[model samples]
Target: MLRELPRIFVNIAGYRDTELPWTIKDLFEKARHPERVFAGICRQYAPGEDDDAAPDGVFAEQCRVYDVHAKDSLGVCWARHQTQKLWRGEEYAFQIDSHMRFVVDWDEVLLDMLGECDSARPVLTTYPVPYTPPDKLDSPVLPVMFARFFDNDDIVSFGSRISLPEDAPEKPQPSAFVAAGFLFGPSKLIADVPYDPRIYFQGEETNLAVRLWTHGWDFFTPNKVVCYHDFSKRPERPRHWEDKVDWRRLNTVSKTRLHHLLGMEKNGDPEALKGIENFGLGARRTLAEYEAFSGIDYKRRLINGKPGRIADLPAGSPERKADRKRRFTFIKESNGWGCEETASGGGSTMAQTEAIRRDLPGVFDSLNIRILGDAGCGDLNWISHITGGLQAYLGFDIVDSLINEAREKFYDRRNHFFSQVDIVIDALPECDAIICRDCLTHLDHQEILPALKLFKESGSRYLFATTHFLGKNTEIKTGGWFPIDLTAAPFNLPKPLITISEEAPNSTKSLGAWKISDLL
Candidate 1:
């Protein structure tokens, strides 16, 4: 790796312990270009007669060491300062935790993987597979993790224990979040987006991911394991958070400021930051595009990534499992149709939802549709169906609270309107085409045909609805979740222009394509 890049600037910060010395020495020795290592360290060694002294003059001009007193208590504050101080003329830079085990030629592995990147700006990072001390068992075979957003915007990753895909993981499979412990990228990227000195440690990854993404850069993990991290925290070793006066409050404030910086609403937009001192987002992409690509809605604190927990929902019993085909539908469901923060949907809208999501975007691409309404009755996947090229998009839900939240979250979108409108009570304004899917099943038996007629009147010639034939279930419980049969109604029921039952994967729910003229 030292051969690949001319010089490497190493920033060793925070109360460094005894192992940091051995780790630093190994870094220089193992490298093909040890002369290229320019380490800037800030440390306070524990007092002891047997403790080794600083190797300041020993390495000559190679390393620059700073001895901060043990009482100084320098936490992540050393990140920006030490990096700037140590940054010599280097082509690339990497930020890694001191307590890590690197494979032989790990530097070469990282540099080669990073060089394979097709992008001008690239980052290779992951929460590396773990390793134990020499006394324990060998490291387990683990694949490169494809991560998902876990509880409360935190990240939890999972991958097969078997065959791992060997390819350019970044461009093909972008990361939803990055590991702060192992971030590798270009030197200019690090300089352009420096670590926020004001930022506490808790939400560092979240802040970095957003700032980097908006700045037109991307992150990916290498195909193979280059390093292993020992997560075992030693009780004898002191921690910075343990010393902070009130770290919880400080962390909350940092995350809150992040909310304002990223244009999210969970923290209620303390102040919409134009740009903070020397740090802020670039003009490469919108946060919404990032949210769509990542399946994360920051304002709602919801994660809906492609391979996220939402997609990895648990399967059913053997008999039920065979019929279950994993499907994705992009319906902007209304409020109260809550999603499990840890899992996807409840196995209802898979087939139809995904079908509409995959197809409807193309519908607009071909036909010059004027408007689309993703009524507030289903999932928020519809938002991903479109980002541009639409004249206007009316995204509404039945619940007022969801509408308000969606308002704040999607406020940056142009011609993307949201409101709380019950189609049963208030008529949805007319549009060139209307998309209402996976929601009709939840209405009362008497309310189905009227809603169909309303959609037909509003959309004119084009309409798309994912429906269940009441003919299949043959049962009606007044107002329930199950679909009530429309054909068997006592009175003359309003019929769709053309209703054709089609089989699909994922859900047992059948799909039907509708046209307003055929139904009316």
Candidate 2:
């Protein structure tokens, strides 16, 4: 009894490339088990002009082709989506451009590298080393994705740079972005996160990376070079945008669909985005979790190299756990939290804070709370409008700048005070009730208990904090984001004495009031 070799489904989207034939030849010639390698091509070419694009002999027999007129082609992603439809229940999915050269035993190399990843669902992807025409490949250096710039359409575009030999990790390194040209992962990725045919071109990689991550697929770049992409072919090749007349209209609609899917466009017309629900983000994780893991903030159009959360490390590895704690400590030493003047983030926006704004004052009066403490008050955005009746209002935040600005802005109001405090370890002031909104969700699991203990040690009788009624509580790195349910297992907090709905559009978020002792 012998074990069978895994089947690999190779997806190539050819848009009038003359190199397609040679690419197929190289693919078959370099694989150790050629019989297990299956190619699926979406060939977009003019009727009589691209006879060479078709596979010949053994290549033809092993491949499945879907032909389309080059003029009718939507875009690369559209063609890739069509190519995915030809999959025949293979074990792995390997996607690459039509013009590529391969290393010897590249299929086996990729499978071996993927096996080294710590995650159960690992996706290996990167921009391949570039090659010139015929047979010339550039120096064999790994290319890793980086946030290049924000395009005019407000979507983040990624660029790649050679990983320095001294800096590149020995194993596959955790990656935050995906390369559309080269991606290799399990066949389950095809079923769980299929490419959106509606996306035209620009937002394809970001869209795929986000959806794959949210669906519980971890990404890593290969430690060894497996293939070379023809970078010089683009100038000579015929692109879909050049051949199609309505390319602009198609691109616009595609970008809008991407924006809505990423939650960047909260006010977009629902009628214009009819079928986007079928291609939205996954339920295993939230968009906010992706933003925290990757430092690319979609809403703010900002890319900070400082990562908030580290990827999941293996459990019971004491050194790795210590390193994780050190990485989180580095964040606090480098800088305090950031907040915008009008809105801090999704949690603190005016729209999401409306319900709490309308109900907090009445609740304060009912509790007979004259002295109030605001734990983790960020920039005093909407909270300033609700503090009219308090005899004294004290605001605390980790960021010194926000605290200083708050003091200067309300200098005329004698009863208002601001101070910088670290809620996890610092001593807290005595107040009737402590309002800790939009704070606990950002702390690491280990830190949350200490923060709760600190709050309990404070003389405050009542605690009002943000809690999500929907979804199970998930852990994140120190500066990350997630909808934390206080009543869940880890916290085991009792039901709130009173709940004020935040009216969040995506989830059931509310300001839940609890006794400080119940939080621990």
Candidate 3:
């Protein structure tokens, strides 16, 4: 008896993309078993206006396209759902965007990579390296996705880093997240964990990754580049957001539904979250198990420090301690942390710093903060906007150059002063409130407690600082970045006396007011 070769069902969601026909051609030409390969594309195009070309010729016999007018199309997830409905029980399913270039024998490559995985069931996915149209690749390397940070919506934004020496250990590596642009897995995913059409755009990967993991499916990244994706969005290509006037409302509803599904919020739009129970988590694995493996606490909206990567040594490590002490000095001299407008991060931008600007003045007045100690002050871009009423604004930072520059720039305000001081080691000047923002996030897990202790002992009546509301306080190297949830375990901080949203509309970033005595 002869064994039958496995068949693959390629699921494509194309919207006004002119490269769809070429992508299909490349896929068929590059596959080892083009005859056995099948495709289901949900082509969302403006019938008479779109530049998209249909896939025809010999490959058309093996491919199916479900046409939906671009103006009527809801979003990518909706189109992908339509594509899933076209699945014809193939042995495997490969999901990809409409613009892509494939390697020769890519089907064989994916099958081999899948075989190399240790899991009984594995899905290969990644943010493939970018390629210019008409075939241009720049030393394509295997890439792995990592958690960049939680955005204002508390959504997990991802960042990709290249995995070097692509030739080594020609096996799939375990991944905590999935890429929506390219995912290849068992055909059962179509029936077991179908794409939720209600999810519009932003949180598609996160939603799919969680549901797949809970359904007993493991994720891995291909060790070698199997395909190249066109990452650049051409201005000519029409997008749903650009065409639809209500895109913002659709996105909000989608995020609300996702927030409910992830257990982040109990209450959301009833209409949007309706029928979500049908797409709830699978019984094969609990959501908690998925969280444990992925290092993402869904309810808390926290990401573990080392999801899959190694961290610097523990807080007690002499090297880490030394690095913590010298980090700011080096950053100032070397301009290590780059920002165009302000040397501080994007959080220090005008829009991001709006919360502090709008609410801090009121808090200062309420607390009668006559002498304000601005610890870890960088550039004084945002804070400079609100230093008028204070009797004394003493800005302290480890960066000597910043202090010198600040001293020169704000010389007109005799009440305003700049000094070089390390709050962790140096004695802080007495003040009514010690305003520390955007500092603790970069410190080691253990260093934060001592810094907090120093702040309390400084005789500052109130501590106004940045407190990430929905994140796990993960251990990290002293100078590395991670959100700090002061109320969570280890920190065990009591509720803040007054909490002002630093970033609004479900954003976890906030400035919390804590009476120094309460911190005791």
Top-scoring candidate (TM-score):
3
What stretches of model 1 exceed 4 Å from their correct place? 1-5, 14-16, 44-60, 77-81, 133-173, 266-277, 305-520
Which lDDT values do the candidates have, in the order given?
0.56, 0.80, 0.81
lDDT tens readout by residue for model 2, 115-136: 9988999999999998986779
Taking all chains together, the TM-score of candidate 3 against the true structure is 0.60
lDDT accuracy of residue 55 in candidate 2: 65
Which 10-residue span in candidate 2 carries the lowest summed lDDT? 307-316
Candidate 3, residues 290-323, lDDT tens digits: the string is 8788778767656784332112234444433444
Candidate number of the best lDDT: 3
Q: Higher lDDT: candidate 1 or 2?
A: 2
TM-score of each: 0.51, 0.58, 0.60
Looking at model 1, residue 446 earns an lDDT score of: 41
Candidate 1 lDDT by residue in tens digits, 449-513: 55676776674556656555544543332223565444444312345444434345544344344
Off by over 4 Å in 3: 1-3, 305-520
lDDT for model 1 comes to 0.56
